[model samples]
Target chain A: MLSVVILGTGNVAFHLAKVLSSNNSVELLQVYGRNKTKLQAFEPFCDTTDNLGKLAAAAIYLVAVSDGAITALTQQLAGLDGVVAHTSGAVSLEVIDHPRPGVFYPLQTFTRDKKIPFAEVPICLEARHPNDLRLLAQLAGKLSGAVHRIDSAQRRQLHLAAIWVNNFTNHLLYIGQQLCEEKGLSFSLLQPLIQETVDKIQQLSPKEAQTGPARRRDVQTIQTHLDILEAPLQKKIYQLLSESIKSTYEKEL
Target chain B: MLSVVILGTGNVAFHLAKVLSSNNSVELLQVYGRNKTKLQAFEPFCDTTDNLGKLAAAAIYLVAVSDGAITALTQQLAGLDGVVAHTSGAVSLEVIDHPRPGVFYPLQTFTRDKKIPFAEVPICLEARHPNDLRLLAQLAGKLSGAVHRIDSAQRRQLHLAAIWVNNFTNHLLYIGQQLCEEKGLSFSLLQPLIQETVDKIQQLSPKEAQTGPARRRDVQTIQTHLDILEAPLQKKIYQLLSESIKSTYEKEL
Candidate 1:
C-alpha cells in the first residue's frame, strides 16, 4: 500500500485526502494544515496536524498548497525521507528542497464545493529518481485512469495551454453572459449552444468546428455586431479576435 | 397536422428535414433546393424539387438558406399562401416579402456531419402576425421542447453573444491546441480541463466560475506565459485578455 501524507487544507488537498484515505491501495498517514479549522475536515479520514514538524512517516509527502507557499513548505520538508512532491501545474519540481523532489499535478481545476470524480482526472507525475517516479506513477494510477509522466518543461507548457482553454474561454463566456443581460435575454438560452460548441470539438478539430461571421469573414454581420457592442474593451476584443481568425483562414485559402 | 415545406440544401435545412419528416404531427410536404445533387437526400423522405416555382402547397414554409439567399428566396415566395419564414439568426424577419414573414432560427450551431438532438435545441421564433406566430410555434413545438419568441433586435444580440461563446471560444481552444503541438504535448491532455471549465459554468455564473492567474492578479504566472508565447499575435491576445480580466477584478477590489 502507498503511504501518503497530504499537506494543506485547500481544494486540491481536500480531494486528494478524501480519495487517498478511502482507496484500498493507499494508507493516508496524516494531513497537515496551518489552520486548525480547515484541518477539521481531514480529522476523520487521517491524523490531522497544525504543526509541519509533527508530520507522520509516509512514502509520499504531497504539498497541495498554493504556488507561493510551495517553496517555503519544501524547505521545511528537506529532512523528510519520503518523495516530496508539489501538486502544482505552474510551479517546477525543483522548488522542493528534498533529495527526491517530485511533482504529482492533477491537470484539472478543483473547486471546494464540487465533488469531482477522481478516477477521470488526469494525474501528471514526475520525479528525479526512477524508483520515486514509479511509486508516484503507481499512486497516480490508483487515483486516476489517465497518468502521464510529464517533465517540468512539458508541465509548464500544459499549464499555459490550460489557461487559454479554461481561463480565457471562461472569460469569453462571461462576456457573452453580459451581452445577454444587456439584451434582456436569459443567459440559459445560450447554454445549449455553449455545450454543443465544446461537444463539437470532441469529434472535430477546433479549426474545423469553428463557425460564425469572424471565421466566414461576413463583413456585414461583423459590422452589425461591432455597432451593437457599447463597451470599448468588448469591441476591441471582438475586433482583435475576428481579425486573428480572419487572418488564420485567409492564409490557408 | 402542420404541413411544412423546407427550402434550401444546407446544414440547417438537412437537420430541419430529418426532424420534420419523422414527427407524426407534421406532414413534410417538399424540400426545394437549387442543387439537384443535394436534393437527392430528401427524395426518400419527402417530395424533392429543384424548381422553386413548383413549390408544394403547405401551411408553413421554412426557408433554411444562407442569410444572403434569404432575401432572394423570400421574393419568390411572395405569392405563396403559407406563412414563409427564414431560419437565420442574423437576418431580419422583414427580409421575407410574403404577406406573413416569420423567423424560426435555431440558436445552436449546426454542421453537416454532426447529428444533433433536435428536441433539446432552442428554437427562436419571430413573426409579424399572431396567427402566423401561433402556426410557427406549433410547428416548432413538435420539433423542440425549448422555444423562445425572440424579436429581430434581440435575435441579433443573441447571435453576437453566440459568436463570443461558440466561435471565439472554439478559436481560443484552437490556439491552445497549437501551443500543445509546439511543445510536443498531446492536445488531449487538456480535454478534461476544458470539459470542467464548461461544466463549472452550468452551476455557477461565469464571473463566479472564473479562476486563473489574471483573475487573481498573479503577475508572475501571467508574465511567464507571455514570455513563453513566441507568436506576437498570441502574445498580444494574452496581454489584452489578461489586462481586461485584471481590470475587471481590480474594480471590485
Candidate 2:
C-alpha cells in the first residue's frame, strides 16, 4: 500500500485526507495544519496535528496549503525523505525544498461545504526523480482515474487557463445573477442556458460552439443590451467581451 | 389537441417542430420559411411550406425567425385569427401584429447539431391577452416541466442575463481553450474545473460560490498571470475581469 501524509488542513487537504483514508490500496498516516480548529475536521479520518514536528514519515507528503505559504511549508519539510508534493496548480514543484520535490495538483475547485468525487478530477503530477514521480503517480492513481504527468511550465499554463474557465466564467454568471436581481427576475431562469453552454463545448470546440449577437456582429442588439445595463462596470464588461467575441470571429463575420 | 403552425426554419423552429410533432396533444400543422431549402428539414415531421400564403389556420402560430425578421413576419400573419407568438427572448410581445400577440421564448441556446431535451428547458411565456397567455402556458407546460409566465420587460432582462451566462461564459471558455492551445497544453485538462464551477452555482449563489486570485485579492498571482498572457486582448480581458472581480469584493477585501 502507498502511504500518504497530507499537510495543511484546507479544502484540498481535507478532501485529499478524506479520499486517501478511505482507499483500500493506501494508508493515510497523518494530517497537519497550523490551525488546530481546522485540524479537528480531519481527526475522524486520520491522525491530525497543528504541530509540524509530529508529522509522520510517509511515502508521499501532499502539502495542500495556500499559494503564498507553499514555499515556506515545503522548506520546513526539507528533511523528509519521501516525495513532497504541493497541491497547487500555479506554484512550481521547484518551490518544494525537499530532496524529492514533486507536484500533486488536482485541477478542480474544492469547497469545504461541498463533497467532490476525486476519481474524475485530473491530478497533474510532477517530480524531479522518476521513482518519486512514479510514487506520486501511484498515490494519485489510487485517488483519481485521470492522472497526467505534466511539467512545471505546462502546469502553470493550465492554472492560467483555469482562471479563465472557472474564475472568469463564474464572474460572468455572477454578473448575470446580479442583472436578474436588479430587474426582479429569477436567476434560476438562466440556469439551463448556462448548463447548455457548458454542454455544447463537450462536443464542439468553444469557437465552433460560440453564438449570439456579438458573434453575429448584430450591432443593434449589442447596443440595445448596452443601453439596458445600469452599472458602468457591467456596460464596460459587456462592451469589452462583445468586442472580443466579434474580433475572435472577425474573419468569419 | 392544440393545433400549432410554425413560421421560420431556424434552430428554434426546428427543435419546436421536432418536439411538437411527437407530442400527442400538439397537432403541428405546418412550417413556413422564406427559404425553401431550410423548410425541407421539417418535411418529415410536418407539412413544410415556403409560401406564407399557403399557411394553414391553427390555434397558435409560432414565429421562430431571427429577431430582425420577427416583426415583418408577424405583420404578414396579421390576418390570422390565431394567437401569433414570436419565439424570441429579446423581442417584445408588441412585435407580433396579430390580433392576439404573444411571446413563447424557450430560454436556452439551441444548436442544430446538438439535440437538447426540451423537458428541462425554461419556456418564458407572455401575452397581451390572458387567454393567449394561458394557451401558451399550456403548450409550454406540455413540452417543458419548467414553464414561466413572464412579461416582455422581464423576458428582455432574462435575455440580457443569458448573454452574460451563456454567450459571455462560452467566450471565456473559448479564451481558456485558446490559452491552452497557445501553450501546447490539452484544453480537456480544464474541462473538469469548468464543470465544477457551473455545478457550484447550482447549490450556492454565484457570489458565494466565487473563488480564485481575484476573489481572494491576490495581487501577486494576478500580476504573474497578466505577465504570461502575450495577446493584447487577452491581457486586457484578464486585467479588466480581475479589476471587476476585485471591485466586486472591494468592501470585503
Candidate 3:
C-alpha cells in the first residue's frame, strides 16, 4: 500500500484518513491537526502529528486545510521531497509555491458526522509535472471512479458554480422554511418538490426542468409570492431570482 | 377499500391513482382525462372514463386536474351525491364551486415513473364539513403518515413557499448547470453538493447551516466567484444571492 499523510482534522481530513485507511491501495501514515483534542479519537486509529515538520515523513502529504491557509501550508512544505497537495477546489496549483505540489480535491462537501465515500466523489486533480500528475490521477482513481484533470482556472470556475448550485440554492430553501414557519407549516412539505427538482435534471436540461409561475413569467403569482415573504431581504431575493428565471425562459416561452 | 374516482390523467393523477391502487384502503373506481393514450394503460387497473358525468359513482371524487380547470371540474362534479375534493394547493374549497367539498392535496411533486411511498408524502386536507373533513383526513392518513390540516389561506402560503424552495432554487441550479455546460463541464459534478445542501437541514437550521464566502462575508472570495460568471444575468443573480446570504449571517459574522 502506498503510504499517505493527511494534514488537518477538519471533516475532509477526518473522512479521507478513515477511507484511505480502510482501502487496501493506501496506508494512512499520519493524521495532523493543531488542536490535539480534535484529533483525539483519530489519533489512536493512526500515527498522529501536531507539528508541521512530521508531515514530510510520508510518501504523500494531503493538506486538507481551509482555503486561506492552503498557500501558506504549501510554502511551509516546500522543502519536503515527496508530493504535497491540498484539498481545496477554489485554490490553484501555482498558488502552492512548493517543490512538488498538486491538488487532490474531492468534489464533495464533508460534514463531521457524515462519512462520504471517495469512490462516488469526483477528485479534481492538477500537477506541475507529468509523472506527478499521473501519480495523483492513479491515487484519485483508487478512491473514485470519476476523476478529472481540472486546471486551476477550471477549478475556480467549479468553485463558483458550486456556490450557485449549493450555497445559493440552500439559502433559497432557508427562505422557504422561513416562509413555511411563518405560516405555521413545516419545511418537510417542500422535500418531495426538492427531490423532483433534482430528479428533473437527470433527463431534462435545467431550462426545461424549470416549473412554476416565474418560469411562466406570471406576474400575479410572483406578486402573491412576494406578498408572502414579509422579510425585506427574503422578498428582495425572491424578486431578483424570479426576474432571473423570467428572463431566462421568456424568449423560449 | 373506499371506492375512489380520480379526475384528470396528468402527472398527479397518474401517480395518486397508482399509489391508491396499491393500498387496500382504495379501489380506483374510474380515471377521467381528455387524453385517451394517457388513460389507456390505466384501463385494466381501474375504470377509465372520458365522460365527466360518469364520476358520480365513486364514494370520494379526487379532481387532480390543472389549476385552471379546478373550478370547472368541481362544478361539473357538483351534481354527484358523494363527498368531492380537489388535489390543488392554491385553490380553495369555495373555489371548488360544489355543495360538498374538501381538499386531498398530496404535498409532494408527482412524476409519472418515480413511485414514492404514499406514507412518505404529507397529505394536506381541508373540508367544508366536519364529517367530510374526517373522511378526507382518514383517506389522507391511509395514503400518508403525515397529514396537515391547512386552510385555503395557509395553503396558498404553502404553495408560494413551494415556489421559492422548489421552482426558483431549481432554476438557479439550472443556471449553474448551464454555466458549467457552457464551459464544457457535466452537471453530475454538482450532485453531491446539491444533496449535501439538502441533507444538512435535517440536523441544522438553514440559518445555522450557511456555508461559503457569503456566509463568511468573504468579499474577496465572492468577487473571485463573480468574475467567473461571465454572463451578465449570471452575475446579477450571483450578486443578489450573495447579498442575501451576507445579510442572513452579517450579525453572526
Candidate 4:
C-alpha cells in the first residue's frame, strides 16, 4: 500500500485527502494545515495537525497549498525522507526544497462543496528519480484513470491552456449572462447552445466546429451586433474575438 | 395538426424538418432548397423541392436559411396565407416582407451529422400579431421544452450574447487545443476540467464561479503564464482577459 500525507486545507487539499483516505490501496497518514478551523474538515477522515514538525512518516508528502505558500511549506518538510511533491499546475517542481522533489498535479478544478470523482481526473506527475516517478505514477493510477509524466515546462504550458479554456471561457459566459439580464431574457435559454458548442468539439476540431457571423464574415451582422452592445469593454472584446475568429477561418480558406 | 413548410436545407432546416415531421401534431408539408443534391437528403423523409415557386401551402412557412437569404426567401412566400417566419437570431422581423411575419428561431447550433434532440433546445418566437405568435409558439412547443416570446430587439441582444458564450468560448477551446498540441499533450486531458468549469456555472453565477490566478489577483503567476506563452497574440489575449478578471473581482471587493 502507498502511504501519503497531504498538506494544506484548501479545495485541492481537501479533495486529495478525501480520495487518498478512501482508496483501498492507499493509506492517508495525516493532513496538515495552517488554519485550525479549516483543518477540522479533514480531521474526521484522517489524522490532522497544524504543526508541520509533527508530520508522520509516509512514502509521499503531497503539498496542496497555494502557489505562494508551496515553497515555504516545502521548506518546513526539510527533514522528511519522502518523495516531496506539490499539487500545482503553474508552479514548478523546483519549488520543493528537497533532494527528492516531485510533482503530483491533478489537472482539474476543485470546489470545497462539490465532490469530484477522482477516477476521471488526469494526474500529471514529475520527479527527479525514476523510482520516485514510478511510485508517484502508481499512487496516481489508483486514484485516476489517466496519468502522464510531464516536465515542468509542459505542465506550465498546460496550466496556461487551462486558463484559456476555463478562466477565459467562463468570463465569456459571464458577459453573456449580463447581456441576457439587461435584455430581459432568461440565461437558461443559452445553456443548450453552450452545451452543443462543447459537444461539437468532440466530433470535430474546434476549427472545423466553429460557426457564426464571424466565421462566415457577415460584416452586416457584425456591425449590427457592435451597434447593439452599449458597454465599451464588451464592444472591444466582441470586436477582437470576432476578428480573431474571422482570421482563424480566413487562414484556412 | 399545424401544417408547416420548411425552406432551406442547411443544418437548422435539416434538424427542424426531422423534428417537425416526427411530431404527431405537426405535418411537415414540404421542404425547399435551391440545391437538388442537398434536397435529396430530405427526400426520403418528406417532400423536397428545388423551386420556391412550387412551395406548398401550409399554416406556417418556416424559412431556415442563412441570415442574408432570409429576406429573399420570405419574399417568395409573400402571397401565402401561412404565417411567414424566418429562423434567425440576429435578423429583425421587419426583414420578412410578409404582412403576417413571425420568427421561429431555435437557439441552438445545428450540425448536419449530429442529431440533436429538439426537446432540449429553446425556441424563441416573435410575430407581428398575437395570433401568429401563438401559432408559432404552439408548433415550437411541440418540438421543444422551452419557448420564449422575444421581440426583435431582445432576439438581437440574445444573438450577440450567443456570440460571446458559444462562438468566443469555442475559440478559447481552439486556442487551448493548439497549446496542448504544441506541448505534446492530449487536449482530452483538459476536457474534464472544462466540463467542471461549466458545471460550476450551473450551480453558481458565473461571477461567483470565476476562479483562477487572475481572479485571485496573483500577479506573479499571471506574469509567469504570460511569459510561458510565446505567441504575441496569445500574450495579448492573456493580458487583456487577466486584467478583465482582476477588475471584475476588484469591483466585487
Candidate 5:
C-alpha cells in the first residue's frame, strides 16, 4: 500500500485527499494546512495538523499548495525520506529542493463545491529516478484511469492550453451573459447551443467544427455584429477572434 | 392537422424536417431544394421537389434557406396563402415580403451528421399577426419544450450571444489544440477539464465560475505563460483575455 500525506487545504488539496482516501490500495496518513478552519474539512477523514513539523511519515508527501507558496513550503519539508511532489501544472519539479523531487499534477479544474470524479481526471506524473516515477505512477493509477508521463516543459504547455479551454472560454460565456442581459434576454436560451458547440468538438476537431459569419467571411454580418457590441473590449475581442478564424480557414480553403 | 412545407436542404432544413415530421399534429407535405442529390435524404419522409412551382399547398411554408437566399425564396412563394416564415436568427422578418411574415428559429447548432434532440432545443418564434404568432408558437411547442416569443431586435442579440458562446469558444478550443500539438500532448487530456468548466456554469453564474491566474491577479504566472507562447496571435489573445479577467475581478474585489 502506498502511504500519502497531502499538504495544503485548497481545492486541489481537498480533491486529492478525497480521491486518495477512497482508494483501498492507498493509505492517506495526514493532512497539513496553515489555516485551522480550512483544515477542519479534512479532520473527519484523516489526522489533521496545522504545524508542519508534526507531518506524518509517508511514502509520498504531496504538496498541493498555491504557486507562490510551493517553493517555500517544500523547503520546510527538508530531510524527508519520502518523495516530495507538488500538484502544480506551471511550477517546475525542480522547485521542490529535494533529492527525490517530483511532480504529481492532476490536469483538471477543481471547484470547492463541485465534486469531480477521480477516475476521469488525467493525472500527469514526473520524477528523476525510475523508482520514484514508478511509485508516483502507481499512486496516480489508483486515483485516476488516465495517467501520462509528462515533463515539466510539456506540463507547462498543457497548463497554458487549460487556460485557453477553461479560463478564456468561461470569460466568453460571461460576456455572452452580459450581452443577453443588456437586451433583456434570458441566458438560459443559449444553453443548448453552447452545449452542442462543445459536443461537436468531441467527434470533430475544433478547426472542422468551427462555424460562424467570421468563418464564412460574411462581411455584412460581421460589420453588423461589430456595430451591435456596446463595449470596446467586446468589440476588440470579436474583431480579433473573427479575424483569427477567417485567417485559419483562408489557408485551408 | 397543420400542413407544413419546408424549403432548402441544408443542416437546418434537414433537422427541422425530421422534428416536424415526427410530430403527429404536423404533416410535412413537401421539401423544396434546388440541388437534386441533396434532396434525396428527404424523399423517403416527404415529397421532394426541385421546382419551386411544384411546391405543395400547406398551412405554413417554412423557408429554411441561407441568409442571402431568404429574401428571394420568400418572394417566390408570393401567391401562397400560407403563413410564410424563415428560420434565421440574424435575418429580420421584414425581409419576408409575405403579408403573414414570421420566424421560427431554433436556437441550437445543427450539423448535417449529428441528430439533436428537439425537446432540448429552444425555439424562438415571431410573427406580425397574433394568429400567426399563436400558430407558430403551437408548432414550436410540438417540437420543443422551451418556446419564447422574441422580436427581431432581441433575436439578433441572441444570435450575437450565440457567436460568443459557440463560435468564439470553439476558436479558443482550436487555440488550445494548437498549443497541445506543439508540445506533443494529446488534446483528449483537456476534455475532462472542458466538461467541468461547462458543468460548473450550470450551477454557478459564469462570472462566479471564472478561476485562474488572471482571476487571482497572479502577474508572475501570467507573464510566464505569455513568455512561453510563441505565436504572436496566441500571445496577444492570452494577454488580452488575462487583462479582461483581471479587470473584471478588480471591480468586484
Candidate 6:
C-alpha cells in the first residue's frame, strides 16, 4: 500500500481525501491546511498538519491548496523529500518548483455534497519522471477506470472547453430558469431536454446532432426567438451562437 | 384508440411516428412528407402519403414539418377535417389558425439513430379550445410520463435556453476535441467531465453549482487558459464566459 498526504481542505481536496482514504492500495498519511476547523474535518482518518515541514514525511504530497496559496505552499515545500503535485488543470508544472513535481488533476467536476462515481471519472496525469508518472497513473487507475497523461498545453485546452460545455451551458440553464419564471412556466420541463442534449454527444457528433432554428436555417424562427428575448445581452449571445452553429454546418449565413 | 396522421419525415417526425406507432392507443393513420425516400423509412408501420389532401382522413394531423414549412403546411391543411398542429417549440399556435390549431412540442433532444425513451421526455401541449387541449394533453400523456400546458412564450424561452446549453456547449466540446487532436490526446477523455457536469445539475442549482477558474477568481489559471487557446474566436468566447462566471461570484472583476 502507498501512503499519500493531501494539502488543502476545499471541495476537491475533501473529495480526493475521502476517495483516497477508502481505497485499499492507498494509506491516508496526513492533511495540511491553515484553518484548524477545516483541517479537523480530515482528522478522523489521518493525522493533521498546518505546517509545510510536516508534509515532508509522506512519499506523495498533493498540493490541493488554492491557486494563490499554491505558489506559497509549493515555495515552502521546495526542499521537501517527496513527489509534490497540484490538482489544477490549467496551472503549469513550473508552479511547483519542488524537486519532484507532477500534476494529478482530476478532470471531473466536484461538489462538496455530490458524491461522484469514480468509476466514470477521468483523471489527467502528468509528471517529468517516468517512475513518478507511472505511480500517479497507477494510483489514478485505482480510483477511476480511465486515466490519461495530458501535458499543460492539452489540459489548458480541456479546461477552456470545459468552460463551454459545463460552466457556459449551466449559465444558459440558469437563464432558462429565469425566463421560465417570467413566463409562468416550470423549469422542470427543460430538465429532460438538458440531459438528452448531453446524452446525444456520447453517440453522435455535435455538428450532426445539432437541431434548432439555427440548424434548420429558419430565419422566421430565429427572428421570433429574438423578438421574445428583449434583453440586449441575451439577444447578442443568441445571434453569436446561432451564427456559430450555422458556420459549423458549412452554411452561408 | 385514437388515430394520428404524422406529417413529416425528419428526426422529430420520425421519432414521434415511431413512438406513437409502437403504442396500442395510437392508430397511425398515415405518414406524409414531400420526399418518398425519407417517408420510406416509416413505411412498415404507417401508410405513407405525399399528397396534402390525402391527410384529411385522421382524427389528428401532426405537422412535424420544418419551422419554415409549418406555415405552408398549415395553409395546405386549411381544408383538412382534423386538428392540425406542429412539433416546433418556438413556432406560434396561430400558424395553424384558431378553431383547430395546436402545438405538440416534444421537449427533448431527438437523434435519428439514437432512440430516446419518450416516457421520460416532457411533452408541452397548447391548443385553442378546452376539448382540443385536453385531447392533446391526454395523447401526449400516453406517450410520456409528464405533460404540461406550455404556451408559445414559454416554449420559445425553453428553445432559446437549449441553444445555450446544447448547441453552444457541444461546440465547446468540438473545440476541446480540436485541442485534443492538436496535442495528441483523445477527446473521449472529456466524456467523464461532461457527464459529471450534467449530473451535478440534478442536485445543485447551476448558479450554486458552478466550479472552475472563474468561480474561484483564479486569474492566473484563466490567463494560462486564454494563452493556450489556438483559435482567436475560441479565446474570445472563453474570455466572455469566464467574465460571466466571475461576475456571478465576484463583482470586482
What are the candidates' individual DockQ scores? 0.80, 0.80, 0.54, 0.75, 0.79, 0.63
Model 2 alpha-carbon drift over 4 Å, by segment: none
- All candidates: interface RMSD: 0.9, 0.9, 2.0, 1.1, 0.9, 1.8
Better structure of 5 and 6 per TM-score: 5
The model with the greatest lDDT is 5
Best by TM-score: 2
Question: After best superposition, candidate 4 residue A57: deviation in angstroms?
Answer: 1.7
TM-score of chain B of 1: 0.95
**What are the clashing pairs of model 6?**
none
lDDT of 1 by residue, A94-148 (tens): 8787899899999887776666777878899999999999999989999899999
Q: Write the per-residue lDDT of candidate 4 for residues B1-253, one digit (tens) a residue.
A: 8999998898888998888888888899999999999999898668998887888889999988888888877776777898999999999899998889999988887777777868899899999999999999889889888888888989998998998899899999999999999989999999998888778777788888787899888889999988778877777778878877887888766
Q: What share of the true interface contacts does each candidate keep?
A: 0.80, 0.81, 0.65, 0.72, 0.79, 0.61
As for DockQ, the candidate ahead, 2 or 5, is 2
For residue A235, model 6's alpha carbon misses the true position, in angstroms, by: 2.6
Compare the candidates by DockQ and give the number of the best one. 2
Candidate 4 vs. true structure, TM-score: 0.95
lDDT of 1 at A103: 97
Residue A81 in model 4: lDDT: 93
Summarize candidate 3's per-residue lDDT along A1-253 as a digit string, tens digits.
5778888887779888888888887888888888889888577568887888777476678988887878877788867777788888877887777888888988876666655756778899998888888888878888899899988887877877788888888888888888788878878787877776776667666776666777656676677767766778777777777888888876786
Candidate-wise lDDT, in order: 0.90, 0.88, 0.79, 0.88, 0.90, 0.79
**How high is the lDDT of residue B173 in model 4?**
97
lDDT of 3: 0.79
lDDT of 2 at B80: 77
The per-candidate TM-score of the B chain, in the order shown, comes to 0.95, 0.97, 0.93, 0.95, 0.95, 0.95
Provide the TM-score of the second chain in candidate 3: 0.93
Residue-level lDDT tens digits of model 6 in B134-198 = 87887898899888888887787777766666666666666666676777777787787778777
Judging by lDDT, tell me the better candidate of 3 and 4: 4
- Tens-digit lDDT track for model 5 on B1-253? 9999999998889998888788798999999999999999998778899999988889888999888888888888888888999999998999998899999999987777777988989899999999999999888888889999999999999999999999999999999999999989999999999888888889889988898899989888999999998978778878888888888999776
Tens-digit lDDT track of model 2 for A75-159: 8887777888898988788887778889999999877777787888999999999999889888888878899999888888999
Clashing residue pairs for model 5 = none
